[model samples]
Target: MSAVVDMPGAAHLVLADGVVHLDPEPAVLEAMLEGWALQQRTRFLNWESTIRPRIALVRRLTRFTNEYPWQWDPAEVEAFFDHLRTRRPGRPLAVSTARNYQNDLRLFFDYITDTRYGWPSMCNERFGRAPVQLLHEWNTITHTSEYEGAAERRPLAYDEVQTLFDAADGRVGEIRARRRKGSLAALRDAIVLKTVYAFGLRRQEACGLDLCDLRRNPRVADYGRFGAIFVRYGKASKGGPPKRRSVLTVPEMDWIVGVLDQYVSEVRPAFMPGKHPAFWITERRDRMSLRRLNEAFETARQAADLPPELDLHSLRHSYVTHLIEFGYPEKFVQDQVGHAYASTTAIYSHVSDEYRNRLLRRSLQARHGDLWGQET
Candidate 1:
């Protein structure tokens, strides 16, 4: 029989007869998880980031249900999901997130119950029963829509974007005026928010930026080194390296040129990140974490009195919307954001009311003379 995708170690290898597992059941469970991880890594080429979370989710289910895989029932799986979704009165997991949890659990079941892997026989021999797939079509969440994110997560208005940036900058001033520490860090945060909107970058894409990723555009020499941004960590396809793209600086967003120049020349060196490739550095001379990036944007959002629903990622959404409003070609906007499909880029766009009104006016003016002048 195949050894769990033909991998060795962990689940694939059995303990010797003389070996003593003080906690035998737990040991077997851990071994199963490890074996599953190894199989995913070796056969599927999944990232550790993906494998670790799936393992944790399985463990969490085991804890919540107070049972091993062999003891689990569909009722318990349904109860677990109900508890997760209703834990907070007003909030629940996004459909995508809930589906991911179900999918991971299903994948785990697929691994443990497969006859070729021998997990069923191992469990049967030790515990008088075998593992079975817990998640079924009826018990699992379904993908009903293409975009199932919260409605709150939409594009910010132009004024709201400006207000957020102003708040970020004002934070730096507040630090300086109070003779406080972190003025440099605050300044970096301010520019980072601007760069996010200017480049239409995802969180990982922005965080993964290196100093060398800044490139000159031969077509737009006026902006010099800030003419384009090389996004090395664009969102990846499953089991694939991150997609790469170069976002050219459009004239509408070219204000980032001076802002980035000031940050690189005047502010970045203060972090003392010698030889560190990360463009955004922390005070401790390490690359900034995604948490810190979110915190900075949150601070500014609250200060600006923007809606609580707005988060750092709204800036990327704002970029797509603004580009559409600015009359850029749909294909150009799609390419700039590295979306595989124009439909995906279209999903990001939430154009403002005024832009739609302008389009309506233009259409009416073409059909009749002095249409706006004779309006009631």
Candidate 2:
């Protein structure tokens, strides 16, 4: 059967008759990749941001095997992952990340081998062999646990949070004391860090925030325009637009009202941001770069003597845990964080032992009401 139009497996004939080529093999491989990309775009309806990395991974696999898709052996898949697992001084691949890579690889091979793709026959005709799936359950990782994140990537202790803020503020003082540059930047960082925790935000979500996103909640008129965070760039599902959610300000974290107000009224204008809509502005008067955001956290983390693993994301984790400890309902916390599942919110929560002890005490008091405040 011939390939059809507007189908994922039918891009173009790779090895057409009388087509002279200096590199026939590479041409065939590229054709396969093009077909896969079209499939992802038209059939799967994936965004470029999602498809780009998966395509890059397939090319990376080609280099690892030095063999075409038809020639790829499952053993090569095992060897490749082994190389990745123990390769060099850097940390090994995260279990979740590795599992995703494996899933991507499996899907690529599945595409080529499927009867509808016409690739199996094409490859067999060209190279006397057909492509087959390299990845299998035996060779690939699985999602066995709910929380497979790094141990260090957890909610920071209350004291650690204070120390982090102090370090960021102290940086501003030090810069001004020395008559050095970047005092304003240091000040901006201190406030931004606190804002990030006050509203449970992912990196991109935080980056996407603007002045317009600051909306007033009628219930919390005391907070005025800072009563809620309108997250226009919440994390999305596969091949979907960014999710949107409005996180209402909780009384416990309402301290962020003053911090954000001061930043907008005083500190942000100092950046000379002319008509820039971004809540976090750079010295160049544009939206803050992710690199700069990372640097801001890293500088404070180092100064506070916090663990290297406690990156900016820890602030978000700290937020979830603190909200839980502060007697917020689980559903409210889940909605505030824009988590699609309660399980995901649970994973983010790393409530302190003291909080757990309080929970246990409350539980005991509920079951034994009359025993409370009595001599045993």
Candidate 3:
């Protein structure tokens, strides 16, 4: 008889002569989970944002089922999710969140069950069973709708945009009047908010911008170095690096050129960030964080007294809507936001009723002209 040796700290049952022994140890299981997480980090660009929460979700599920991945079943998954729904009486998970959890579990199981990972093989050799996918299409939530986000989230109206900008600009004067020390920082925050809207940038993308990313557009020489923003950290696909795009300065928003030019020439240098590349910098001369960016927007929004539902992302939505209203092509708008699909771009667009009426009138006029020409 061959004896199985268990590592001291990482003890797990070993198969010998095709006979089953003890249960797999927690240490051995955790090591395998760590390897899976490492693989995910290697493959996904947004892994840093997701890994911790995903690992915690898995651990919670394990605790709920009182079993390891190899012992899990479809019934266990169903029960686990059911428990989640009722875990807090008034705080049930949102439909989209529940679906996301289901998808995350499927991906996790897919990795461990794959023969290349050796998780299934190791389990089968030791415990006479292997991990199988617990969540299936029938059991998971169906993606029946195109836009599953919160109903309250929406683009700001044109007047609301103006009010928000005014609030941001007013913060500078407010600080100065109060003889506060943060007046310069308030000006910087105002410009940052405008830049986010002007470029339709995500919070992280805006935070990631550097001074050098502002480029001169050959087609628009008047705008000079402020003609286009070279976005280096656009939203990424599932397992891809951050996308890149050049957002050209449009004629409607060309006023940003002067604002940026003045800031770069005078205001920014006051921060005394020697050789720092970040366009948005803190008083410490370090790069501005995403949290600070959100705080800036929230401050402005509250001052403007806009809807509570409106957040920093609403600026991006407003950019999409206003561009469509300005009669830019759908394809052009889609590229501006780095959306993988045109449909995703469409979801962001919420044009005004007046703009829709104008489009309808133009269509009718063109139809009438064609009819008159046919009669002739």
Q: What TM-scores do the predictions have?
A: 0.94, 0.93, 0.85
Q: What is the C-alpha lDDT profile of model 2 across 132-197, one tens digit per residue?
A: 887877777767899887866888899999999999999999999999999998999999889888
Where's the lowest-lDDT run of ten residues in candidate 2? Answer: 2-11
Please identify which of the two predictions, 2 or 3, would achieve the higher TM-score against the true structure. Answer: 2
| C-alpha lDDT of all candidate models, in order | 0.88, 0.86, 0.84
The alpha-carbon lDDT assigned to residue 163 of candidate 2 equals 99
Name the regions of candidate 2 deviating beyond 4 angstroms.
1-6, 13-18, 43-48, 369-376
How big is the RMSD of model 2?
A: 2.1
Which of 2 and 3 is the better model by lDDT? 2
Clash pairs detected, candidate 2:
none
The reply for model 1, stretches above 4 Å from the true place, is 1-10, 14-20, 43-48, 369-376
Segments of candidate 3 deviating more than 4 angstroms? 1-24, 41-46, 63-66, 82-92, 124-129, 367-376
Rank by TM-score, descending? 1, 2, 3
Candidate 1 vs candidate 3: the lDDT winner is: 1
Can you write out model 1's per-residue Cα lDDT over 1-376, one digit (the tens) per residue? Answer: 5544444433546444556787888888888887887777775555556988998999999999888988888899989999999999888778889999999899988888887777887788888999888888887877777798997889999888888999999999999999999899999999999999999999999999999999999988899999999999998887787899999999999899999999899899988889999999999889888999999999999999999998888999999999999999999999999999999999999998899999988888888866555857
